[model samples]
Target: MSGLVDKAKNYVAEKVANMEKPEACLSQVDFKGVNRECVTYGAKVSVKNPYNTAIPICEISYVLKSDARVIASGTIPDPGSIRGHETTVLDVPVKVAHSILVSLVKDIARDWDIDYQLDLGLTIDLPVIGNFTIPLSRKGEIKLPTLKDVFHKK
Candidate 1:
């Protein structure tokens, strides 16, 4: 069981590490012992803001891949007590910060792509999965597919 959990963790870590360069950076990731209690893990992602500033963050995501088919995971920002308010990664250029967030979500999906059926432990929900379809266009807009010619109806 522990071995399975470790394999899953490695799957996620490798996904992040393999992302296209200059857009994201991750390190200090640790997958602690796993059990029924919880799937504990810790790490930091240095997201490069659109302005090209490196924002380092410390986060822990709880993943219970063993209990449920779809695992739930979310990130918590630094308290800002140690790194100070200014250094907190969450505070940075808006677009760059957003890009970082988008990248994180994408990483999860990519990680889950591997050994998805075999593990059946990681489940990605709707909201998160929808994010995958959000296109990264320079125009900065998400165009919904048109079911009908609304413009012509009138």
Candidate 2:
């Protein structure tokens, strides 16, 4: 009886391992805008759902790091759902305080850009599988806006 139960557990584990799940990519990061207190940047995540129906997203958690320091970290609860058999683009806004950016002037002074690593977890409620998180990471440089660009009108 114990052996039969173990075999059933193994079967289920194998099935879950072979299941086709959603995939995500941190597509791009760019300068969003600047405010009085902080500068805002936007990260774009592209997610492709494989299921036949829409999957409800539980949360989108993100960590933005620079110079081995966490510049920003937060969770966006219940952003929405991913469409079935289609790709969805989600925008995550990251705000870094002026103080934080001031602390990294050395790196920025080189080329007027900041080097960053963005870590994101895309959590979704999968049928029968419960909640699953898709981990994604991206490393790149964000070019800072020049004084002219900031004051330029659209």
lDDT of each prediction vs. the true structure?
0.29, 0.93
| Candidate 2 Cα errors over 4 Å, as ranges | none
Candidate 1 RMSD computed on C-alpha atoms after optimal superposition onto the true structure = 22.0
What digit string (tens of lDDT, one per residue) describes model 2 on residues 18-46?
99999999999999888799888999999
TM-score (C-alpha) between model 2 and the true structure: 0.93
- Model 1, which residues run further than 4 Å from truth? 1-23, 27-29, 33-36, 49-69, 77-154
**Per-residue lDDT value at 79 in model 1:** 25
What pairs collide in candidate 2?
none
Give per-residue CA lDDT, model 1, range 79-116, as digits (tens): 22222122222221111122222333543454432111
Best by TM-score: 2
